[model samples]
Target: MNIIHSAVKRVVKKSLIVALGCAAMLSTTAHASEKVYRLKLAETWGPNFPIFGDATKNMAAMAEKMSNGRLKIRIDSANKHKAPLGIFDMVKSGQYDMGHSGSYYWKGKVPNTLYFTSMPFGMTPAEQYAWFYHGGGMDLMEQVYAPHNLLSFPGGNSDIQMGGWFQKEINTVDDLKGLKMRIPGFAGEILAEVGAKPTNIAPGELYTSLERNTIDALEWVGPSLDLRMGFHKIAPYYYTGWHEPGSELQFLVNKRTFERLPEDLQEILRVAMRTAAYDMYTQATHASGKNWSTIQETYPDIKVKDFPPAVLKALRDANDRLLAQHAEKDEQAKAIQQSQADYLKQVRSWTNISHRAYLNSQAQ
Candidate 1:
């Protein structure tokens, strides 16, 4: 009897220990399963910025779907949470986890930021993407953002943009003198040197400002957005050629927040952005062609003109001077410019053979 009782006691103790161990393991698993991360994203543009807004929203949707609802993102548009231009700083400070805006908008903080946007007479969407993805542009861009506590990804490209809208015909560079125009980044600086006063206005206020005669000219995106905003109704004269060759938008993430994500999640974000970038370019290009067709069909009263040779020459000269001045003051600007120039030279070689040949054939 004594032996049997001792055996029984040992069995009970072992059972208890086993049960406790199982309970601890289950608790840890449950805690991990319950953990969820929420990312807050902000953007300066409104919902109407065409591919910019559409691609951003699509990214959030894709993230949630890909994570199977494990990760969530909350996006705030301009003035929804923070001011438009405040997005870069907000994300950098970790006040926000993510931001979407044109890199050129932040050129004030980092002059080199303009290189990631569009340069005067710069490469088109295909050429720019080649430079960025395969030509060391991404690595160089990362270096530029490192000091700002941010990580950036290519968001979207605006393809080729229109010159601008003018209240009065700009037959010569002399017409630009004293013209108050809404432009931004290096383009704005170039305009200033040529005697046009550049102003940065939010999208929503653009129409009112132009209608009220507060601005003499404005350059938004292309005809699609400009037509939607009634820019043609107010500023009847539209000019095209080399003002903003191709504008690229960027998705910026807080460096700390980005580092905190799991490796798998990080990869998901990257893949999602890359997909978004491609989709944006495709959609913008298609929409631009359709919109141009519509403008010819519908807005027959509107006059479309190209920048005269003399005006283009003056603008190009001014842009060169502005770039040199900024590069002298900022080392990063010099580095990025050099990288872009080198990348363009290589891409242009192939593009001249392939893309240019194709375009020329079509024209013929």
Candidate 2:
């Protein structure tokens, strides 16, 4: 009985030691795995653009929170770290760890980037998001940015926007000729094709330029933001339907910076961006609706009208021609355009049945 008791004691002692060793190893690993990275994030807009600016802040906050404070992002607004349009290049060249801005602004460098932002009569915000998330649009965009040593994710989305606020009524295509307008990307190109001189102005200068007659017209954003900027006071003719269709904001990261992140941190960034994308669209839609009502109530003199059918047709035709021209000049543009067309075809098939049915019911 004594010999049996001694053998059992030895086995019990060995088991306890093994368990204690495992605990010690686990504690050591937990201490060793703690990681911290301070990321510099840049934005091309002021704090006044809450949906855009605030969403970026929220993204940073989410990353910190999800990573348990291991990752910190410091955001610098335009002119603080770099110029507004210089964001993509700044991130690509590793001058900035990350950047938040409209993808269309970089069309000169990568024509395909414009599709990720807006196109003449392109998809609405929800549809565009669907394309990006499920329709393989995100993968395609990553491919386009791969060569630039950057990776971009959808940060926010401004739902369908308003057309420009014109100083004088644009009743015909002829009136657009020689009109100096503040616009960007494909819309700017289309404006040029129609003989209007398109100018790219920073957000800060938009109101002053319009008030001082530096620009005959300007398309800044939807009604909410436009109202805040007081564009209606300068140009009272508010047109319907944005030339941009759905303007999507992008968050760009240096490829090397992204690759250096832990797998969990990478996921935190992507999921946070996806969440921000939805939140931004929701906020913009709500704000736009409220602001639209306010505009009608307070600014009785402001005229809201739809673009003439002829003008719309002319613009659409011009867009097609410009897209074709771009495809011929840029191989990357051709690939992106083809990918978008194919994905859009599939999404439209589903949308025609689901989205169309809902819209038709609304009309009823």
Candidate with best lDDT: 2
Q: Give the Å error, residue 286, model 1.
A: 2.1
Single out the weakest 10-residue window by summed lDDT for candidate 1. Answer: 43-52
Clashing pairs in 2: none
Model 1 bad stretches (over 4 Å): 1-34, 47-49
lDDT per residue as tens, model 1, 113-187:
778888887788888888888888899889989998999889988788888889999888899899999998788
lDDT of 2 by residue, 1-364 (tens): 9999999999999999999999999999887557688899889997545788978888898888988988889999985874877898889889899999988898888878888887777777777888888887888899889999999999888888889899999889999999999999889999999899999998889999999989999998887688888998889898987476678999999999999998888898888877877788888888889998998899999999898999888888998999899999988788878877776777778888998999999999
RMSD of each: 2.6, 3.0
Clash counts per candidate, in order, are 0, 0
Error of 1 at 291 (Å): 1.6
Give residue 47's lDDT in candidate 1 (0 to 100): 55
Deviation of model 1 at 146, angstroms: 1.4
Which ten-residue region of model 2 has the weakest summed lDDT? 46-55
